[model samples]
Target: MQIYKVGGAVRDRLLGKPVTDIDWVVVGATTEEMLAKGFRPVGADFPVFLHPKSGEEYALARTERKNGRGYGGFIFHASPDVTLEEDLIRRDLTINAMAEDDQQNLTDPYHGQRDLEARLLRHVSPAFAEDPLRVLRVARFAARYAELGFTVAPETLELMRHLSESGELEALTAERSWKEIARALMEDQPQVFIEVLRECGALKVLMPEVDALFGVPQPEAHHPEIDTGVHTLSVLEQAALHKQPLTVRWACLLHDLGKGLTPEEEWPRHIAHEHKGLKLIKAVNERFKAPKDCQELALLVGKYHTHGHRALELKASTLLELLQSFDVYRRPQRFEEFIAACEMDARGRKGLEQRSYPQADYLRGAATAARSVAVQPLLEKGFKGPELGEAIKGERLKALKAYKEAASV
Candidate 1:
C-alpha cells in the first residue's frame, strides 16, 4: 500500500498557506486493497477512499478524457498503470503540479518547484486545451497568486485564448464556472482574472452582459472612463481596498451593469440607471445562478441608486420607519451589502474630472446607523416568533410610513 501526499496541501504548506484539506495519491493500491487496509470507500463515480482514523482522502490514480461536452462530460480512467507522473501532467498549472511522497519527499517532474519559485503559472502539458474549464482555472490562479508575483506563461495564455474562442466553454456547467469565479472573487486581485478572461474572450461567452459594458460611456458629469466595465472594475478595486464581505464585493462588480444600456447622448444623460440596472440584474443573477440573497442585494443597490443618504438626518424614529419599509429579515444583510457596494461605487468616481456622485461618508454613516438600531435593538426588544415577524415586516415598515402614528401611540 503506497501513499503519496498530492496537490494543494503540499503546495500550500510549502507556500506558508494554511492547508485545510489533504488529498493523497495511492499507487499499487486498488479500491479493494484500500478497503482491506481499513479505509472506507466513499466516492461513487471515482475511486476515492477515506482513511478510517485520519479521514484524509486517498484517491486511486486516474486519468480523464472529454467524452461529451462541458466540465462534467468527461470519462475517468482509474487503473494500476496510471502513475503519479501522469496525474501531474494533467494539471492545469505548473505551480500545482508538485506532489510529495508519504515521507515528505518532493516529486516534481514538471519543475513545479522552479516555477513556483519563479512565481510563474505555466501549463504542465499541452493537453490543457482539451478541458475548457482550465481557462477559468488559469484566471482564478492568476487572481489568487497575483500577490506572489506570478504571471501566466505566454503559451498558456495563447492556449486559453484558443479554448475560449472555440466555444468549448459553453459546454461547461454554470455551477462549475460560478464556483471558480466565486473563488476568484475571494482572491487578492480579482480584476486580474477579469482582465485575463477578457483577453482570452472567455468573459464574452460567460458574461456577455458584463462584456456589453465595454466602451459604453457614462454621463460626462460622472465618469471619465468611456465604459461601464471600467467604472465597475474601479468599484471592485475600491471594495478590494476596503476588504469587505463577498456580497458587497459582488454588488460593486454589478452596480453599474445597467449603465451600458442607459442613454447618454444628451447633456444630462444616463437617467434612471438604477431602475434599468434592477431589471438587468435579474437576468444577470439568473445567468450566473446567483443565490436569492445576491439577487435581492443587486436589486436593492439598483433601486436605491438615486435615493442617497438625505433621509438619515431625520429623527431616530423616522430613520427606523425608513428602514422598516424594506423587509429586512426576508433577506437579511441585503441592505448592508447594498450600502457597501454603493460606497465603493461612489468612491470610484471621487477623482474623475467631472464626477456625479456625492461623497461616500454620508451614505455609509446612514446605513451603519440604520443597521445598528434596526437589527440589534429589534432583537433586544424581546421580539420573537410572530413578534419578531411583526417587527421585521409590519412595525419596521409602518414606523417609516407613520413615524408619528407609531411613536405617539
Candidate 2:
C-alpha cells in the first residue's frame, strides 16, 4: 500500500502556514490489509485508521456517493482498487484535494495548487453539492483565509446558495451546526463567516434570528452603519479584533436581536429593545444547544447590554444588581468576558470602531469595590441569616455608591 500525505496538511504547507493536523490517505489497501499492517480502525462510518506510533489519522483512499440527506448520509467505498485520483476528486474544495507522496512528489489532479495561487476557494467537482456541511466548511475556510485575501469562487457560492435553498441545511443536527459555528466564531475574521452564510442564504435557514437583522434600520446617530445587520457584523469584528473568547463573540452577535423586531413606525428608535430581545436570544440558544456558559452570557448581554452601555448613569443599587446578575464574585472571568462583549457592542458602530470604552473599566472597578465589602464585618456586628444577606447587600450598595461618587469627580 502507498500512503500519501493529503488534504489540509498539503494545502497549508503550500500556503506557508504552520500545518497543525496532518491527514494521510492510503491507496491500494483493503480493510484486511490495513488491519494486518498494525493500523487501528477508528472511523465508525468510513475506513479510517490510527497510526500506532504517531496516533495520527490515516484514512484509506475512498470514494463517496450521496445516499440520503445532510452530511452524514453518504456511502463510502474503500478498497484496494480505489485510486488516489478518484479519492482526491471527491473532496469539497480544490485546494484541499491535492496529495503528496513520501518522496516529496506532488499530485495535483484537480489543480488545487493553481487555486491556492489564485487565492480562490473553488469546489473540486459538481459533486460538491452532495453534502450540506460543505457550505459551513467553505464559509469557515473563507473566514480562515480572509486575511490572506482568499475568496470563494462565484460558481462555488452558487452551489452554496442552492444548498441553502434546497432545505438541506435544515437537516443538519444542532451539534454539527454548532460545532462549525463555535469554531468559526474563534477565527481571525469570524464576521466573514456570517457574511458568507448570509450571502448564501444559509443564515436565514440556520440562524434566522441573525438573518432578520439585515435591512433593519437603526438610529444613524448611534450606529453610523444604520443597518442592524451591519452593526452586528461590526460587533463580531470587534470581538475578534480584541481576541475575545467564544462566549463573548457569540454574545456580541446576538446582542442586537431585539433591534430587528422594532416596529416600522419606531424606525430608528428601538425603545425597550434590550428586554424585547431576550426571547429571541433564548430561541437561538435553544436551537443551537449552546454551552450553558455561552447561553447564559448571551441572554445576559441580550437583556442588559443597554444597561452596560449606560452603566455610569445607573443608580448605585442598579449597579450592584447588575454585578450580582453576572455573579461577578464567583466567576470573575465570566464577568470580564461579559464586559468584553459589552465593549464590543459599543465599538461596533461605524466610525467608532477604535473608540475607547470607559464603561468597561467603570463596571470592573465597581465590581471590585462591591466585592471588597466584607461579609465578616457584618457578622462581627451580629448580623445573621436573612438579615445578614440584607446587610451585605446594603454594604455593597454603599461601596458602589462611594465608588460612583469618587469617579464622578
Instruction: Please report the candidate that would top TM-score against the real structure.
Output: 2
lDDT of 2 at 152: 96
Give the clashing residue pairs of candidate 2, or none: none
Q: Once superposed on the true structure, which residue ranges of model 2 sit more than 4 Å away at CA?
A: none
User: Whose lDDT is greatest here?
Assistant: 2
Per-residue error for 270 in candidate 2, Å, reads 0.5
How well does each candidate superpose onto the true structure, as a TM-score? 0.82, 0.98
Q: Find the number of clashing residue pairs for candidate 2.
A: 0
Residue 252 CA error for candidate 1 (Å)?
1.4
lDDT of 1 at 127: 79
Q: Could you give candidate 2's per-residue lDDT for residues 1-409 as a string of tens digits? A: 8999999999999999999999999999888888897989996899999998899999999899989999798999888899999999999999999999998799999999999999999999999998899999999999999999999999999999999999899889999999999999999999999999999999999988899999999888888899999999999999999899999999999998998888989888999999999999999999989999999999998988888899989999999889999889898988898889999999999999888889999999999999999888789999999999999999999999999999999
